[model samples]
Target: MSSVNTAIQLITREQAEQGATAKGSTCSPALAKGPWDYDLAEALAGIPAYGPGASSADVAPAATPRQGQLPEAYKLASDAELGERILAAKAALGDRAVILGHFYQRDEVIQYANFVGDSFQLANAALTRPDAEAIVFCGVHFMAETADILSAPEQAVILPNLAAGCSMADMADADSVAECWEQLEEIFGTEPDAEGRVPVLPVTYMNSSAALKAFCGEHGGIVCTSSNARTVLEWAFQRAQRVLFFPDQHLGRNTAKALGVPLEQMPMWNPRRDLGGNDAQALLDSRVILWHGFCSVHKRFNVGQIEKARKDFPGVQVIVHPECPMEVVDAADSAGSTDFIKKAIAAATEPTTFAIGTEINMVNRLAAEYPQHTIFCLDPVICPCSTMYRIHPGYLAWVLEELVAGRVVNRITVAESVQDHARTALERMLAARP
Candidate 1:
């Protein structure tokens, strides 16, 4: 990864000379209540049924569902029945449909995945597959939206459950982003630029909304997943003097600081704050302004847990994701994305002991995959990414069976206009390659 940085620097330096451009948005000084940080109650809601304007809630936290029972259609069906349905769906859809699954998906669903990996990898996977016309994205809404942006114009992307959205992504919506931009412009001018030709680049994590992506697309911005944050940031630096990273402030702060940015230069933007997260002194002094947002799942891990892991197993390698709280990341040996974790382990030559600050299922699976090596999750708590957990095997079986039938249920489509802007942002990252 360090070796890749030199090449990134050179390409970005060349791009800086080319200039920054924001083409579509007439709201030159873009404007956003940034999004709420968390809403656990949203997870309790079952995935809302699809079509236009739908919501899923098992019950309001203030209340409860009508009964303990899920829908009768949701009763656990036999695995064999599911297999048959999947085969029929494949036969019926033939070359027109593809299934994209997240690594966190249950084995039952993973078994049927046309492709399985992290969110960005899944999006890249969806972009290929020339045989498929409709992509059955088996992940959450943010993921499906990413696929829609990456796929061919004719391709139809679908999310089985409309309510299957990512809370992390929800943390930063367009309205809030717009408001933030408006505030920034008020302080820093309509387009904070050195030459007046440069536009402030907006880079969103893949864990954001289709609308957000469109916002980026419309502006001179693009979307990045955890796996490609560094690449995306490298791209942003070329287009603008500063970056406004959304939702996961920790990831933004951690990544920028690691790239040699000083802590004092990294300011947190809290939408709930009076200044829209901008403290004039901090804003003037900083380079990366992280929007106040976080991942409740990763936040669950703590430094104490890492200390305990070290005590339990001496000489264990402690690896974590930047999404973790700063103190937790400070205590770990290293931090990176899910793919980075896998690659680091794979690159290790000898049998090693490892502790990971990430989802337990992935850690457990890695341990099993590398029986010769020892691996464990940092937190002993059994909590999971609850939203990702919503993708139960029951839903998987139903989706596959539905595919086997003659009907195509959930298809995701990012309008071409949105894609046009989104593509510019994505191309910038790809172009950042040395």
Candidate 2:
């Protein structure tokens, strides 16, 4: 993973508290909301976070090292020079190339994107450009894989930085999931209920790999994004006795909890241990079996920070993404997907104060866009999505230049077998959208 050269300086919670106290003010009340278990500053350095039982030793596919040792020309070029080169390459390629960027991407990279949006929107954005010969994705690896699965076969999906990957996605490997599935079948059996619903249904979050999505589709399951998680789960329940949700425990738990599923009924699956460290009885009674996975950036946000923001600024509207822990999501004013957060601010007519609990890059961008409102991150520390920042302007320029030279660089392709099943899951999601 790589770090972005942005103007924002991310600090730790402790550092923020000390700085505030030195200014003759106190915001520690918010800091007291939850335990600051990890160093928030490490997020800016592009470090991934593992779940309770999952370790780096779990051994997923290694990330491509695009961030290491840039070419001399790119290393020496100024920001302006790189920006000009990117623009020139795009102009030369014309309609043959299309650049898609995630909202969490840096301004430098986002500026070059022909379409800028969240994951769901970017997936659909690729579909809208079938005439494009190449889709240059300025996001993480899985996202590019998704675009490849959804886009036309003639379209080449390229991730500018191959090293860019989701920490949460890496938590659940295909082999571990396969073993878990076998164990689950052994306990639950392959029979359907009286209503003709299967004993269990597999539901994977969009942040996961194409292979995982294919697994879900092959097993009569569906893929879900944060925006449509609730709907996808509802769809799953219609045809299954219980849902096996993976790659993002928080989203599954949060959505299930809201739908009246008790916390006691949601058991976490620790891939490193047998039966996921749970007894058979608990597994039998479970409604949503949560895989041990979480977003490092969202997990860093604490309720203490939210409470402190409210204490410092009166009537502050606190908003967060559903990927956050249930406690933090519950403590905030509202929770939704990234697009929802952006719209919430856009819909406000009067000047407002917002305390957002998501990535720092999006928060900072929103703050700049909505000058009328005082928008700041709930987490006083600056922690952008490390993987999202891996798509630097230099990489963007390099890929675009290659495309202009009648060459495709860093193209991502899914196997026909995997693509067929992954597309099935994605199509289910599109149709299941509320």
Q: What is the lDDT of residue 86 in candidate 1?
A: 71
lDDT agreement of model 2 with the native? 0.81
Candidate 1 error regions (>4 Å): 1-74, 91-95, 191-199
Candidate 1, residues 1-434, lDDT tens digits: the string is 11111222344444455534522211111000000111222334542221111112111222211122223454444557757667676777777778787866545566677888888788889777866877877777778877888787667676665445665676687788988877766666656466543445688887777777778877777777676788778877877777778978889887887788898888888777877655687776767888887776687789899999899999999999889998888899998888889999988899999999886557766887787888877766444454554454455545556666545555556767767777776666566552
Kindly provide the TM-score of model 2 when superposed on the true structure, using C-alpha atoms.
0.88
In model 1, which range of ten residues has the least summed lDDT? 28-37
Candidate 2 residues 1-434, lDDT tens each?
A: 11223333222343465664432222222221111121222234445332111122233344423333445676567789998999899889998989998989877788788898998799898888889999999888889999999888889999886667777888887889999999999999999989999989999999999999999989999999998999999999999989999999999999999999999999999999999999999999999999998887788788899889999999999999999999999999899999999999999999999999888778888998899999987776544565675567788888889888888878899999999998899899989968
User: lDDT values of the candidates?
Assistant: 0.67, 0.81
Q: Which ten residues in a row have the lowest lDDT in candidate 2?
A: 30-39
Model 1 clash number: 21
TM-score of 1: 0.79
Clashes of each: 21, 3
